[model samples]
Target chain A: MLNEFFENAPCGYFSFFDDGKIFVFNETFCKLLGYDKEALKDRNVESIFTLSTRIFYQTHFFPLVKMQGHAEEIFLSLLTNKGQHLPVLLNAKREEHGGKLFTSCAFITVPNRKKFEDELVAAKNVAEKALQENSELLKAKADLQQHTERLDAQIQLVNKQNSELKQLNHVVTHSLKEPLRKILIYSERINDKAQPNILKLARATKQMRVVVTGLQQYVWLDNTPSHFTHIDLNDLAEKAAAQLRQELNADLLNLHMVKLPSLEADAEQIQLLLYHILSNAIKFKKDEKAEVTITATALKQNIFRSVEHKYKYEDFIKLEITDKGIGFDPAFKEYIFDLFRKLHDTEGHGLGLALSKKVATNHFGLIEADSRINEYTRITVLLPLFQTTR
Target chain B: MQKNILVRNNVKVFGNGTQPMLFAHGFGCDQNMWRYITPAFEEDYRIVLFDYVGAGKSDRTSYNAERYSSLHGYAQDVLDVCEALELQDTIFVGHSVSSMVGLLAAVEKPEYFSNLIMVGPSPCYINDADYIGGFERKDIEELLETMERNYIGWANFLAPNIMGNADRPELGQELTESFCSTDPVIASQFAKATFFSDNRKDLFKLKVPSLILQCSEDIIAPVEVGNYLQENLSNSTFKLMKAKGHCPHMSEPEETIMYIKEYLG
Candidate 1:
């Protein structure tokens, strides 16, 4: 029976001398490290791990084994012969073989680290990108009073001219939207269309969008469009929450919403923007506590007339959504909106925030964030309110 | 079949006597932990020794997650062997983690074991109102953090290691390198369970006649914890091993085995 087990045992088992030389390497360890019986017998423990980590093992880990004579279930990385790391915990005994001491041990490996790291990075990149996009929008808003002044001077004093300018601005902004969307689509499509340059083109398309937003008057809010529609902020809140709950697994989340007042504006884009922010907050949770709140209220419609976004913005409305959960590195705040940028090695980048940013700005709105790591993150969306507020 | 069951861990049954005695190893060590103590019992007893799933020579693949996350999983493994062997009126001997495991096994299946000889058993790792196990939550947390940072093969990362931990100097780094180890996740969970688990209830429910060995300066299982087990376990005799550190069986094996023989008599 012992012979059968020695050949086909489930867990890793082996032994090493106090000097960190291998006296035994079991079938499991051999399989995990992809080493042969001959290879293992002659290998010193130090030669098995990589240089940076081998030194660690020599200084910290192996010494403990000698002193303690044994250890149980310690999670650490082990390097295989082919140079791949195996995460394992070891339990050993101080064996007296003749006059010298040795460690007789066994262990098991977890294969979840890489997967977890990927998920963390992807998710982080997406969140960071979203926040970065919001920052760009805020920066645009700050440049607003100045741009509005310059543009106002260009087409001031003539009502007919102002109306004509509005039509041109509409055409320019609306056309920019499809092409921008097409850029993102084509870039992602390039992954399959031109696989070699997928990463390069992907990066290009994202950078191109930033330049477009920065170079041109990103948004041209009409002063008082006849087509302005009444948007029920409460309805938008409910819609966003319903969709977010479904996306993030409602059973795992604590979502709360306050009755919000209505404000009329670009309903389609406003709805789309809210949905993205809320969904994002929901996606970032992993066994940690998650909570989200979305609330909106009418802003006094007069701020629009005073605001003058390059001579547009006939209204003002504010919507707030707050999430308390794992946050990101502040150092990457600028890179958050960059496509393919990852923070925690999880998944996805740039799309959520870029799309949300586009929807908000194209609809004559602003979005910004105030965040601290492992703490609360608040996103504020400022949009133009329609005259008939509910 | 029962011999085969433990054979995967290289646990050989030595000696040729009718009265069977099982020796359980402690944490940080394996069934080989009973090497010195078993020699004394061999002449008079049918000696049994086997490694726990996480210990020496055991089948690493056989270590089931849902199964071996707690000490009771080990207890069940002991019972499995006892049932397989059809051993009765057996004297159960356990060291460190296995001591508590043997106690739990005896409580659950008393028919096989007549007396449990617990060498350095700790019911809990925390200092409760009455018990002082010489470990604090922070201390355990630091130990766990140490494993996460150092002991586990955290740095030999495949590629693009996490900037924070994959680089920083970890606590208990020295302890981590001694041997081939288990996965970090399992190690963390095990540490939490071992250090934080409160088995005061298990002690209260123990029924078998037992001998509780307490080492004078055992870092892992303190003297008070042994006394606590003795106080709770009726018909249990308590003796202080004149030694220190976690494994008295390794440090002072001669005296440790001598005390066991006297307890048996």
Candidate 2:
């Protein structure tokens, strides 16, 4: 009765020698493997295992059993005679019987259990992937928060600086202006050998007043709020050129202006931008004839202002103003954009190009200068065709 | 300084002889795997065993993901253990992936090692156009899945026992201890590093004489791989063993020892 029970047991039973040669197995084990007793003779236990299971058996399961004498509840898949994988829950124990050592193993086929476990593992993997993605999103949000906070702090600092500059502008316009007027009037009244020196002093004071006024205009650009509207660049360029012609009283100021695309920008600021650039070309002329040409092209590209700031624009109008004049060294291309930077010590307070850059920046644009010594100097202004309300 | 390195890797030194024989374990296990093979060498050579940082009783806190991400990191562990013990002319015995690890160490510092004994070693596990590594990428993925299921089973088995000894935390330590206990995450990373790595290019850099002990039916390192290694590695002796599967040092230690002794003689 015990022999019949062993053969008819629900779980498959097998015994292998320490060298992995199978010596005995139950009928149920043979049926599960779809192999006859004769066919199973002289076969190793690993012969029935799939590739991955054989690896697991050799690397993990075999080692565990050898060290701990038994391994329970191990998951492994066995290959049957018909070449189908049969997932099984395996329990193994190393035993010494009749002065010889061998291993006894019981296998319970668990197809349903294996399927459920795989589903659970798949779900767990999905959850883990979701958690990883969520954490990455949270990190990105935190970085953006940090960036916004830094920008807010920078804006507050700029506001404070602008208010302080406003106070300085008030002092220069009111307090310094009255004293300079007194000096010029008193110098003109002097009638002696000192009269020539007095005239020189008055001329210096006049130049100081022009510099002070230019400083006021430069500071005002930051204080005033910009009002953007659709402005025709052709009209603005003509008006600027005509004004320069009237002011310089020189018909030799040749201006070849191209048809430019109308873009949404601050009309007043753009007008100032055009006037400053045209005036610089005329002021730094080689001789009496000041020849300037303006051309425009539309581009879809990115504007790189600095390493940290890059703005992508779908549509941008690039305006190039080239002047055949006595251009300064190309090294001072960026330096010429500073408020008090003058390369040739010419007439004017050296704030023209700086004011032009300020106006272009306020309109979300970039102005760059490319020049060569005693050749043509080209000033390129790239402005976005469309403006978003700030 | 030596004590810190020793503790970090759980370095154990024992022998009756003067020359050092450093044994490096492979993935999925620790230095305890050498127990079956180390006894034969204990009388004739100094036996040095160490758990690579994240495995066994070594310092788990020192497991840096970036450092242990490649075989080079494990190679550094071998070198560190060598430097700490001040071993010279060492006969290095490495099993499985540690074969490549030992190769890297010997290539980096050839002065410290004299011979490399590799058991069931494969330079690459994934097959390419010209080389057959005996596994597809899919098979490795399945292995990783199986590993995860087993680790989960272990965790589930330990959870209740851990909760029962919540008041006695010291008892919890013993309850959690198991043979070849490796951190599951580190094991997975180690698996990726081992199976996915291609150290074929590093074979030419080996200056030390070596022995390749290829098992009969090793799915991990097939006979073709052993032949490939013998052909590629200069001044190397290849021996095909009767023992089947990987880990011949454990399964057939007597034969493993005889080959080492013969080669050393």
Candidate 3:
């Protein structure tokens, strides 16, 4: 009865010596591999395993069984004689029979269970991939949030600087105006013995008044609201050239104009911008002739003031103004646009480029300058053709 | 700091004599792997054993994926243990991948070690045009897949056994609680670090005298790799044992001990 039970059991059982020689195996084990008991006399246990399973057996199974004296629920695949893989759930234990040490193993063929387990593993891999992608998206969202916060901080800083500039404008208008008036009146009333010094004081006070007015205008650009209207650049450039020629008292101002696109912008600010650029060309002329050229082209591209503020405009106008003037060092090209920044001791209060930059920024545009030490200077202004409602 | 290193690596030190003998375990198992062989040296040498941060009962929270991603990270662990114990002129015994780990440590700090004994060491595990480390990239991938499936199966099997045998501690212990049990994620990472790593150039950097114990028919580290190490290493001895498989110290401890003793003598 015991022999019949051993031969007809549901699981296959095998015992191999420490050298991996098969010493005994149940009839069920032999039948599972399609070999009779006599045919498996010299066979080693690892011969029936698939290559991966063989590696697992040696590296994990054998060592584990040897150390712990038993290993359970180990998954491995065996190669049958018919050249097909048989997935099996294996359990092994180290046993000492008499004086010899051997390992006895029992395994049940688990084809259907292996399929289920494979599906589970595949599902796990899919879930892990999805989790990884989700985390990446979360990280991207966090980066965008940080960028927005930085932009907010920058906006606050600009607002603070604007307020401080307004306070300086107030001081220049109220505090310095009364004192300059008193000095001019007192100098005119002085005796002839101090006439030279009094004249110098009067001239200096007058120049100071002009600087105070320029400072007010620069501060007023940010305070006043902009009025948008359809303005033709060709008309504005002609008027600006005429104004500059009259202001400089030089008909030698040679203004070369090109047909430009009509765009909706602040007409007053655009005229001021044109006037300043033309006046600068004539003022800083190399000799008697002030040669200035203005051209405009339409573009279709996005404009970025900063990385956070990207203006996707349907149409844009790129205006280039080139001048044959005494250009300063190229290194000070960017610095020349700062309020009251002067590279040379020229006439006027060094506020032309600063006012021009302010007008460009107000129209959601950008202005960049390029120059050599003695060559011509080119100022490029990029503006949206049609302003979007803010 | 020294106490923290000891706790982090689960370092154990106990022996009879003054000379220090540090044993580094291989990829799959922990320091318990040296249980069978450390006994023979206990009479005359101080034995040191430790688990890598991710394996065994070492502090799992101390595991940094970036630090332990390379063999040098593990070598740093060896050096840290050496410095923690203030060991000098130590005899280092390393098994499988730890063989390369010890070699790297010795190369960096040669004064910490005197002699090296490597059991089934392979500098590289993938085959090149002229060298054969006995595996292709696909084989290692398949091994990883097999490991994943087995870990899932083992976890599933152990969960119920633990739940049902709450009253019987011995019964719970009789289950798949073996020395090779490791966290699946860490085991997979360690496997990638071990198999995908190529340490062929590092062989020339060793200055300490070494012994390479090459086992017969080791699929992981074949005979060609042993021969390659013997040729490249300047002060090294090579031995091909009759034992079969990747781990000889476990399968044939007596032969392993005999060869190690003969080399040390």
Candidate 4:
């Protein structure tokens, strides 16, 4: 009866040698692993485990049992002959017999405990993932808040600049225009043909009117809000060419137009921009016929003076108006774009490219002029395909 | 911020004698585990008791996980305590895992200690081909799992229930209740550090006189481990007490003191 009790014990028991060869096991041990008692006698315990569990058994389980002499409540999984998992809790003891070390192991099946442990591990991972996502969300919210604050600061700066420009316009109109009007009236009243000072005075009055009008136009462009609309550049170029023909009375002004994409922009401002640029091209022509080629091409990179601006990586339409005109020196290219900056004794106010640049900045775009002395002038205007609203 | 405060380890110094005896508790509980043992040595030795960081009331804020990831951290804490009290030629009695902690301390700074007494000590808890450390990897993992599940209980309730040591209800009850008192997170990390650490290679590095007190039937550290220490240690003697559990200092304090006194002589 005692031998039967040992054979049919409630817990499975087994013993292994130092080389991991199974020396003996109870009937219960063989039943737990679904192996016949004779078949399990020579088997290594690690063979019944999966690859990862086998590694854990070698690196952790065996080493721990060696150091601590016995290990209790160790959870592990074993494989059955039919390819099924059997989760078990192991308690092992080491003994020295005849100068050789041997280990005895007992196994108790606990399937539900394994399932519950897996659930807890999954829950922990889920909580960690949620924490990571929460931190990312907070970071995004902070970035958006910073962007809004920066935009508010920029708007306030622009508003302050606009009010200052308006104040200057008011001061210029009241102070400068009144004295100039008096000078013109006084010069007309002294209409003495015998003195050459009257002619000089008349010339000075005309120049004053031109300067004041240019200043007023500049101030108005700086302050006035533009109404944005969808505009086809092909139609815009034709309209500008027609208007220039009507103004200069030159029907033979050659304007070679290529296909241009439609865009959302301030149509009036853009038309004014085109008119100033086209008129300059026509007026500055040193050849027999005024030949100007206007072509629009999509750019991959938004390039400026000599540096590259990376506001919008792509989606920019560059309109290059090349003219075989009497171009200035390459050194004077940037200087020609400054307001009231006269490089030559020209007929009009030196404000065409400056006004074009102002219009481009208002549209969140850029304008650059490249000219070689006595060769050609290319005035390139880079505008986005879609304008961002304030 | 003061190293003195941290190094002091919230020391409870009692008794008065020519020789100083510092008691370092093991993992699971704190310095209170020596309550049953300290009184026996109170007459002839100056007894010093303190808790490791993250255990009992030893300033939990000072607990650094990275610093305390190995046995070296606890060893450094032992040296820190020695420095704080200016202890010299002290007899260091360490229980359970603190035995290795004290051993490491004596090896690093031998001047601070004269005799090292390791109660139920295992240098490494994992077994090798030639050594018997008593536990496997899965066993330690289960012990950690058991700690995690039962750390929040008013009484650990699982270890005693599983061990079936109902005869000594108060000892397990005291240990179980103490388990709930620590920060659960720190307790779990400490468990991993204690059981997973392999100090077997450092056995030959001892420079101080030592005593290995092995319990008769300890589930944690058995007799072979103590024998291994005795054989490997340069100046050490092994003694086996007729105690049943891993903590002979608690269950059999008089016997423990007898061997300690005998070893000191």
Best candidate, DockQ-wise?
Answer: 3
Instruction: Report residue B131 deviation for candidate 2 (angstroms).
Output: 1.9
Report the lDDT tens digits of candidate 4 across residue range A41-128.
7886666765334534543355434433455676666778776777777888777678767788888888887677678756865785
Superposed model 2: Cα runs more than 4 Å off: A129-390, B156-176
lDDT of 3 by residue, A200-236 (tens): 8877888888787777777778888998889999998
| TM-score on alpha carbons, each prediction | 0.39, 0.59, 0.59, 0.42
Report lDDT (CA) for all predictions.
Answer: 0.64, 0.83, 0.83, 0.74
1 versus 3: better TM-score goes to: 3
Alpha-carbon deviation at B156 in model 4, angstroms: 6.8
lDDT of 2 by residue, B1-265 (tens): 7898899998989999999999998887778788889988999899999999888778988886656777877887899999999999999999999999999888766779999999999999999998999999998998887787777655533332333333234433442354567777788889888999998977986879999999997889999999999999999999999888788887788999899899999
Q: Which is better, 1 or 2, measured by TM-score?
A: 2
Stretch of 10 with least lDDT, candidate 4 chain A: A303-312
Candidate 3 similarity to native, TM-score: 0.59
Cα error of candidate 3 at position A66, Å: 1.1
Judge candidate 1 at residue B140 and give its lDDT.
Answer: 67
Candidate 1, residues A331-361, lDDT tens digits: the string is 6655655444556554444455655666556
**In model 3, which runs have C-alpha deviations exceeding 4 angstroms?**
A132-390, B156-178
True contact recovery of candidate 1 = 0.02
Rank order (by TM-score, best first): 3, 2, 4, 1
Candidate 3 DockQ vs. native: 0.15
Candidate 2's error at B121, in angstroms? 1.2
What tens-digit string does per-residue lDDT give for candidate 4 at B1-265? 2355544476788896768999998876677667777887888888888888878668787776655776777787788888887899999999888999998787656769999999989998888888898877877786565544433231322233324334334444444333324676677778788889887766776778888998875657878888888888888888888864566665467788789878887
User: Which stretches of candidate 4 lie above 4 Å from their native place?
Assistant: A1-118, A125-390, B1-8, B152-180
